[model samples]
Target: MHTDRVYVVTGGTRGIGAAIAQGLRDDGARVCVLARQPDPAEGVAVDLADPSSVPAAFERVLDRWGRIDGLVNNAGISKVGPSLDYDLADFARILDVNVTSLFACSQAAAKAMAAQGGGSIVSIASMTSFTGQPERAAYIASKHAVLGLTRALANDWGPHGIRVNAVSPGYIRTDLTTDLIARGVLDVDAIEGRMPLRRFGQPSDVVGAVKFLLSAEAGYTTGQALVVDGGWTVNGYFK
Candidate 1:
């Protein structure tokens, strides 16, 4: 596929997903955004948790666009609280949207990519994937599952010319992270201090990684998770 190939971004309506989708669009790729809300950017209503909706969503992609050159499974939900006091529904809901929906979408995308010669999948994971933090059991578990899904898809689809990988972000300055830090639920200063760069990550800071991983530059890379955390992961996150 060419550099300006088409892409589909789940949860492209907001946050990091929106940033990534805009990056792809800026590269001249035709983008189909699968979101809960409708907008002029061209999106559809699809809840990630429902398995039945997964195939139909992709069908819409095929109907609207000839082929899917890339897929960014960036839609995820998190529930933070002490595990002992966690709401059962919240935990399940987190896993269903973050882990289960990603699996379904990757499967659907792989089928499309495999038939079309090749494609790339970039899953949005989290920094909690490799570290244990308090009151985020569901988020942590789902992110780990995302890494597994990325690797599994790479292993099964690489031979078919499909590449699957993930990007794990740490301490982004999005509304969610800002709110958590503001409420003292997350220690932004401490987290940023651990990074050699010593600052919270910007959404734009991660767009390059996504662009490279999806481009021909990453032709040989598969089954990998790129952590864009400003050295936080490498230093064991300590001063």
Candidate 2:
């Protein structure tokens, strides 16, 4: 059980965001999830790009729950293409959500956490940050920026009893990945051959990491990026 603590998860309607929210709820924590097309199931209606929307969204959670204990910055935008081919507007749009919005959310979360004496903020990063993935220039850049934000915040907030960190998933099976599969752009099953685990990751696999990172058990940890790639990034060959 989460002892009545609450968590706010962005992009919680589907994919990894929903999974993280569900995982925390299963552990008895209350959840508030923000995203576009506000789903009744999620209980939040904040647009990540609208920084002003974040505070009011957090306020709603506090109004209903009284306190915020954890935040998961699981929402982001990505554009894949040669960096030079990127339209100036499209490139900035990616940064708008993936970096700027997340940066704002983390700040809001920290403000609440500071008021409560301590808390955790978790961002979903990507393996593209560590290795070059062709045609995903904007995405890779944003993730690298997220990692940097995590580290900087960790150093500044750890002393204040707050932890900032990220979870970088390898190739995980989801609607996003499914589309790639259907397009034959990524072999959903074949790529598993390259991962040591011999399979794509499940939402639960990444959720487990979130649970641990936010739990009291990880009190001493912060500013670290946890890679949950099923061994996909550890090697280029052999699953």
Candidate 3:
């Protein structure tokens, strides 16, 4: 459906980002993945923690593809610890990679899209964006900021034919979640028991939502957060 379209995916080396990138490619879209250590074939090496690296990466995409039709801001990091003892540096670093660099990438993409007359931007938000979770203050804050920025940019760039949106995934089984589980930061059985779907989400669960947002099917949609959590955020009572 996305034949000939050029898209950029941050953190596309693994997990949700990898799924999204491959999904786009399967649909015939030309994809450029940005990661610290990239796949080399279609990947552009970038460290999202360093905002300065974002522009050049996008520039590389434009140089190669001549235009970018969509951008997925999926790169992020988290530091799990008590908020009271959380190092300020760690907090800042999380924000730098998750929020600041996302905006940097968006700005770069928006500039290119504006020149080309249109584009779509989909960011990977989290369920923590709407709820509070212990030991993830920085991550939660950065996700909240991501949603806010999606709304703000949608309003600001709508006139330029740009559509900005977000996808909020919950309890997905990825390397990040495995680490959280190993560290006792999350309990798999407890989460699955409480989740309405009664299972942990896989990375593939999020691919369809993201692809929809970036396609003409969602042409009229913007500034919205499409939740792919299988009812985790809406459940008012425990299952």
Candidate 4:
């Protein structure tokens, strides 16, 4: 059903974003990667921190494809520090990129989708959207807002045939996590022991969830947060 559909994925140069873009492409959809450093061909270089760039990027996609069938708001940044010590500037920047940009892109996509009659929007939220982590107040706050924004957008755009939802990924094995492991800061075994699946997820894991939300299979789904975290949030006491 996604064949020939045009989908835009932000921060899709690598990691989970890249996986989502590839999954859509593999499903026969035309995927555009929007990021500060986008690849050539299907990539559109955009600065999500700058509000002006958001609409321009979406316009580029529409100019090329004429319609926006789906949007994956996957661009985000995280900061680690005690809340009391967190710089105000850093906090604002995080909110700008993670929250503001997400809303702006969703707004632009919604307009295009409304014009075309319908579309889907999925955001890549973090497990922190549900549970808090130490020294990540800004990231957690932004992700929590992501869920709220998803719900609000759904309420406003559902009548227009637009679906808005979010996917909360838990402890995905990516470059950031690998770097933590290399620095001896991340205990992979301990983390796996706590997770019911006893393993970290891959980018493809998130990709599947995003693609499902964007496809017709989830036409009835909206204003929901799909947690793809290996049952991390449900288990209060780890075995």
TM-score of each: 0.94, 0.94, 0.95, 0.97
Report the lDDT tens digits of candidate 2 across residue range 27-119. Answer: 889888888865666577777776767777777777877887998999988777777778888877888888888988888889889998999
Global lDDT of each model?
A: 0.86, 0.86, 0.93, 0.91
Write the residue-wise lDDT of candidate 3 on 1-239 in tens digits. Answer: 89999999999989999999999999999999999998888888988889988898888878877898999999999978999999999999999999999999999999999999999999999988999988899999999999999999999999999999999999898887899899997888888878889898888889999999999999999999999887889887864
lDDT score at residue 174, model 2, on the 0-100 scale = 87
**Deviation in Å, model 4, residue 203 alpha carbon:** 1.0
lDDT of 2 at 63: 81
RMSD to the hidden true structure, all candidates: 1.7, 1.7, 1.5, 1.1
Among these predictions, the greatest lDDT belongs to 3
lDDT of 4 by residue, 6-42 (tens): 9999999888888888888888989889899887798
The candidate scoring highest on TM-score is: 4
Between candidates 3 and 4, the one scoring higher on lDDT is 3
Instruction: Tell me the spans in candidate 3 whose CA falls farther than 4 Å from its real position.
Output: 178-185
- Model with the higher TM-score, candidate 1 or 3: 3
Model 3, position 57, has a per-residue lDDT of 86
As for candidate 4, its clashing pairs are none
